[model samples]
Target: MAEITDDQINTALARGEAVRLAEPRAASVRYDRQLDRVIVDLTNGCTFAFPPRLAQGLEMATADELAQVQMLGTGSGLHWKALDVDLSVPGLLAGLLGTASQMARRAGRITSSAKAAAARANGTKGGRPRRSA
Candidate 1:
């Protein structure tokens, strides 16, 4: 039996292929910028950190919208109506990095316009509501 080299493993990963692992029983996930990695805090109390650039690339949100992203579930996926960005965590984890940033940028414009309208309706000039007397 021969040991697999890192280049081979990375090549398989780059092709959107799956790689078998030892089946981690306990793994918690979170982003860590200081370490520039996605830290998977495990149930065994051990932490595994992955590169942030890779995770960010795989994310379905823009740089700004990514800041506003809210994780909807513990499993996978994120939703940001304000940014109009929705993405599956699994795809990201697998390094898919689909098209969500553009959508979010476009949606951000719409959201801003809507907010402006609401502000206008509320009287942006700060005038008191006129009495119908």
Candidate 2:
């Protein structure tokens, strides 16, 4: 095993702060059944909401199950005890809805916002040009 050093720990903490910790932590998270979304309030006075179905593991969760949302580690994470699912506030804010590969798959899907935007832009330009015979 590699011996740990104080310098290494300090460096890691500094890096962590610059990345995720730089943003205000989530002050609260709740499932709003009426809207079918999870709402999160941040320490920086911002509120964010997303549908449970948009999340990877949360796709099949019932509204009652999603209502089990709980704040983890001083608002750094949202956890569902019954489902054994945990997600990071910063990661969610950064658009990371799942593990790396899952997010990549989402990014590549035909329904992705980027692809839709591209299609819309192409339509405005009269779409594909005619092929020369």
TM-score against native, each model: 0.30, 0.68
Predict model 2's lDDT versus the native: 0.88
Backbone clash pairs for candidate 2 read: none
Cα misplacement distance, residue 108 of candidate 2 (Å): 3.6
Residue 51, model 1, lDDT = 48
lDDT of 1 by residue, 1-133 (tens): 9999999988988664332232232244554445544445543455455443344343443444434545544434555556565555556545544556844564565657778787787786685578898
Listing every candidate in turn, what is its Cα RMSD in Å to the true structure after a full C-alpha superposition?
A: 15.9, 5.4
Clashing pairs in 1: 37-50
| Tens digit of per-residue lDDT, candidate 2, span 1-133 | 9999999999998988776557668998999999999999998899989988878889899988999999998788999999888998988998888898887887677487887898899899999778999
Best-fitting candidate, measured by TM-score? 2
